[model samples]
Target: MSPTSDLLAAALAQSGFHPRLPQQRRLYEAAKAAIHQQRLGAGGKLPSSRDLARDLGMARNTVIAAFEQLAAEGYVVSSRGSGTYVADLQAHSASMRGVGATPQGRSTAPAATPSARLSRRGQELTSYAAGPQFEIQPFAPGDPDFSSFPFKLWQRLQNRVWREARNDLLDYGQSGGHLPLRQAITEYLRISRSVKVEVEQVMITAGTQQSLDLCAQLLADVGDTAWIEDPCYWGARRVFQARELKLRPITVDSDGIAIAAADLATKPRLIYVTPSHQYPTGAVMSLARRRELLDVAVRKDAWILEDDYDSEFRYTGRPLAALQGLDHDDRVLYMGTFSKVLYPGIKVGYLVVPPALIPAFRSALYDLQRPGQLTVQATLADFITLGHFTAHVRKIRQTYGARRELLRHMLAQKLPRSVTISREESGLHLVIELPDQVDDMALAQQAAMQGISVKALSTYYLKPPIRRGLLVGYAYCTPEQITDYGRLLGTIIAAEAAA
Candidate 1:
């Protein structure tokens, strides 16, 4: 059959629409739409896998796999000499008219099914609207400007680690992490964040997400209350929810997590806070609130998990001390990630527990956590100890600071008076609060149509009637891209407000 015939046949078969996988279903729907729209006409040759992949902005393998599946189902025909062809779909259309129904005249698929498997706790999650075009922007949250990383210095340190590393580095070094890296982290946290902990108190995790998971496992029993911030980080909330913990959201103010007059009726066993720079909202926890929270934790005998992600990128004024620094009763468990400072793919983050809890935490981690690659940890330790890590942080701090300023300036120029931009002092993201009339989720979806990615703050909330705001990230985008993105976002927001 000709290429057009094969394409038509595949489209016709897919129109019957019993896709086992959601991704496969999406591909089938897209293919059917293309055929029905006459994009793939009878006798017309279908595009090559490479061409289709390029056009669709998908992996070549994905396109090839889709085509192969279609061919296997007798929807398309492929030959050795001629390219793949659309099958004569008209021959099958009549027979497929009733294929949507089962033999007993009922729908084959259920109306509702279980959701996809949950990702690990605290994993960096991209918004639903984030696509290739969204990624093309300069500074989206959770991304570091990899181009700014000092690869040459990193390579040299890696070489040295390889030269000096012992055979034991090849094996599983430790459940906590490589000893040297743990030692380095212990020292670094003590000096930098005022987190008092010994090398034994530090446990290396896959990132902040794993740290959250480890904490959840160690402290929270199912159905226990875990207090999270209102409009908090979605990943953390999901982690708590996955463990079947009841999530209690506390409202946040300018100084950060507002625990005053909070409904403690649930009597939460754990409190998760991003004190350095609050996630999404970017509000720094004030010294008073930090002290108040520590007091509350002590009173309630609750464990506090302080996620210090992106604390190293403070652009304006001095960096605030970590919440763990203010803990007097050893109730705070501090978590830090190199994912933001070094790179995301490194999958290296450290958790500092109280001295008394170290043994139990370590024991639990060893039992449940998969130890990271020893060689990488050893190399990373050498990088930090040799001062390359500090130097890289210094360089990127300046770069991110410049980009933050540029983004803020652009927003001020483009955005209306009603739109409020929050806390551009530190971290990769700023929260844009729109007028109450505008729906942030709808605005984000609309922006996606224009190839601009923006996150709605409402999705992070667990309670009903969510807030309306956008989380704008600037870690990956360049200055120019930020300007363009700002203008585009301003236009979208303005249009939405008017509508």
Candidate 2:
């Protein structure tokens, strides 16, 4: 569709437009929508009132009145003999200056000028998009069924927090986070993950990625070396890279993060591991490796950042206790988020560190960002304290467990026996290893064309010997959808394999 009419239809689709409305108001909304979407650019001529009415099936008089109202509001100008035209947006106000950005976030404004060049690091960061967009195509990894969250309960909790708000809540919160939320988290972690910590050690932040950023800022220097699991969560690795840390990708096996003698020789400044459940690969770190890692950190005087994301969604045997729970030297900083458990919108995550790091972390937090989202933190504290959070986690864990099984069953029935499947005890996704001859990148692109969004396993590697596979997430879709998706994936893989 042409941009103008297309945007108009989209805007109208989002509206509760009523014919009973005063004619002027209806026209005003239509004109404003068109302008806001930049479907009608500055000085772009709009259809005549009669033509607009006929096209939209509205009253001609109503369109005329709306046009008059828009003119009065400086949205459009009605020429003496010509049709109405959108006002010069840049001339109107700051709000109207860039209504024509394309879907990719590229500005559609012809008059817009380029800004100054970005810094070297900014340019480097933008050279390639580093992480998943979480686009909800079939088999996309790491996303949960966000729609299943109990919004009514959340709404009630939010109302309670706001209703009880005193004057102190109006100011910026303490940089470390809300104390009550920290206390709640401290209690929860001690019971659930077996991490022993006082409330003072819990530093609430936005989420896992922010937690990683904080670790980079507070613990390590720009050129310091960080040893991450080879096929690590790309998002966290990118955070460390953004802080200009040199990354060393250590191999991961069944025991998780294979720290070799050579790795010890590196004397890494920081070590990042997903010990509860290694990301993408789903390898749970063994107790032996966990102990070895803790010992290495103590010997090397290195900091360990434990990412416990998705550890709450285990469907198999009881999850292994967090690596931080095993640390005796106070070297590991444990970070966990409510994003996977409750929902991503909460933006609430906490860091449990050594008592000595608390002051530095709290100070660095304010330096990086001003204290914000106090109300959200407060509501989440109530949700956790009242046991709603645990209840929700239990319910969704069962649902995801069933979905995971359905996925496995379907893949087994439909796919070739040569497809090597690796299933682990927990996490949202599984690794499906493809044959060496099959180009994983090409397969991923082709699968995307067929409405799947799984990532090629080769893309996760930063060292020699890339692993050829696909990471398929089974947590979000229904069992029926999983079966259908499996059928489609099997067909796609069959065709790709033959070629």
lDDT of 1 by residue, 34-88 (tens): 6446576534456777776655556778777877776665445565446665544
Number of the top-ranking candidate, with lDDT as the measure: 2
Task: Determine the backbone clash count of candidate 2.
Answer: 0
TM-score on alpha carbons, each prediction: 0.75, 0.76
- Tens digits of per-residue lDDT, candidate 2, 1-499, equal 3355445555555657655666557657866867766767877777776667766667888778877777766666666665566765454223246554322333432332111134568767877655546468778987788877999999999998899966666666765888889999899889878997999999988998899998998888989999999888888878988999999999988789998878777978899999888876778888888999999899899999999998888777776688888888899999999888877777888888899998888888877767678888888888889989889989999999888888887777766766767778677887888888888888989888888888998888888645688889878887777999888887787666666
Q: Residue 195, candidate 1: how far off, in angstroms?
A: 1.3
Window of ten residues with lowest summed lDDT in model 2: 108-117
Clashing pairs in 2: none
Off by over 4 Å in 2: 1-116, 130-134
Model 1, 257: alpha-carbon shift in Å?
Answer: 1.4
Backbone collisions counted per model: 17, 0
